[model samples]
Target: MKCKLVDVFTKQKMSGNGLTIFYDYDVLSQNKMLSLTQEMRQFESIFVSEVLSKSSVRAKIFTVEEELDFAGHPIIGLAGHLHEESGDVNPRTWQIVLNKKSVKVKTKKSGDYFYASMAQGKPEFISILSENDKHAVLRALNLTSENLADYPLEVISTGLPYLIVPIISGIEKARILLPNFEDLLANFGAKFVYIIDIGNFEGRTWDNLGAVEDIATGSAAGPTAAYLTKHQLASVNKPIIISQGRFLGRDSEIEAYVEAKDNVITNIWISGDVAKVANIDFV
Candidate 1:
């Protein structure tokens, strides 16, 4: 199998979320894919099983533990790579079909990297945690009541669900302690928690999946943008610039926008830069 290692949401190499794109991945069985993902141990590994069209392909996303219905950075990175191979004719939209739904991605090449933008589904507001549950989450994050803001802790989903946590003090004060990890996971009703520093655009996310921390999460960014827009915290027309992976030493930036018609947010789009790191072939 041929694998291409690419970093998403960063212009520089080794500074963003890493993804392994397996070419002709559909040839492997599900169990084989799972085993290979575990062996690779990247944040997320993607299998490009079939190139359905010039601008579309069938792709599957998997973490080390299990296969995911959808993921953000992997989609963006794969879209960028596909865009690169698509000869410099005219810009076209690319579609990636998952088991449940298909996402459309548009890419524009600029100098060295391709800026990939993915259109996420409409936002689904799930639930807001209670005060007690919220407090428990604060403890899990190694934060206190003082660190919290007046904003509501929301469970939002663009494709994948995430607990969008607003940090009052900022991301610098936000930390994830392993001891309280499971409690937070259960309280949020999701495996991932995306903590956004309301003051700055900085953010960090921890997932209960095999991968603990993500450098830049596109899936979470869509919900984060929706959360900010729904709360009137950020403007829909203006892009929300989110910084992540600073704590992990891989600084990345993700730009998100919520498209609105009349008075409602109809669509969400997240765009980021992608850098190819390496290409390897396994015999």
Candidate 2:
């Protein structure tokens, strides 16, 4: 099988989040895909199969742990790769079908990199953490009320549900303390947690085990943008720049745009630049 390794959310190679993409992966079993993802050791891997058309394909995403119904970076990275392979300088649009939904991504080739953006559609305001749940989350993150911003800790989802924790400072000091962190999030209907430094426009997230911190989370960008716009911290219809992966030394940048009407968020878009790294042949 042939696969491509690419860096997402950064124009520079070796920076941003690394992704492994396999084409014609429909013949692989779920267990085989999981094993391959673990072998690659990338933060995530995507299996692309069933090319329905020149501009449409089916994809399945996997972390080192398990399969995901929908994710952000993989779709963008896949679209970027497709654009590059097409050898087209003009912008192209792709429809990526996942387990949960279909995402539309627009890809354009730049000087040496490709930029891709996906329409995440309307944001879902799942729930606001109750005072009791809020305290539990703060404790689990080694944070107190003083460490948080004035905005309420809320759960939001574009594709994956994320508990958006806005903090004022000490982002470097935050860590997941509980072993059952995933269970903790499940109690509040969140699949993951995204802690954002509201003032600096930086964010961080880890796996459920908290063993690995994600370099750049395209999945979280849409939710963070919606959270900011909902609270009036960011103006609607403006691009919000989010910086991530700095602590890991990868350094990635992701941009999000939120559009709203009557103070209700209507559309969310996440965009980033991708750099092609290398192609790998798996025997």
lDDT scores in order: 0.85, 0.92
lDDT score, candidate 2, position 62: 95
lDDT of 2 by residue, 91-128 (tens): 99999999979999999999999999999999999999
Estimated TM-score for each candidate: 0.93, 0.98
Instruction: State the weakest 10-residue window (summed lDDT) of model 1.
Output: 205-214
Q: Which candidate gets the maximum TM-score versus the true structure? A: 2
The most accurate candidate by lDDT is 2
Tell me how many residue pairs clash in candidate 2.
Answer: 0
How far in Å is the alpha carbon of 3 misplaced in model 1?
Answer: 1.4
Tens digit of per-residue lDDT, candidate 1, span 124-224: 88889989988877777778878777898888998888888897784666667656475557656666788988888788876563237778899999999
Error of 2 at 159 (Å): 0.9
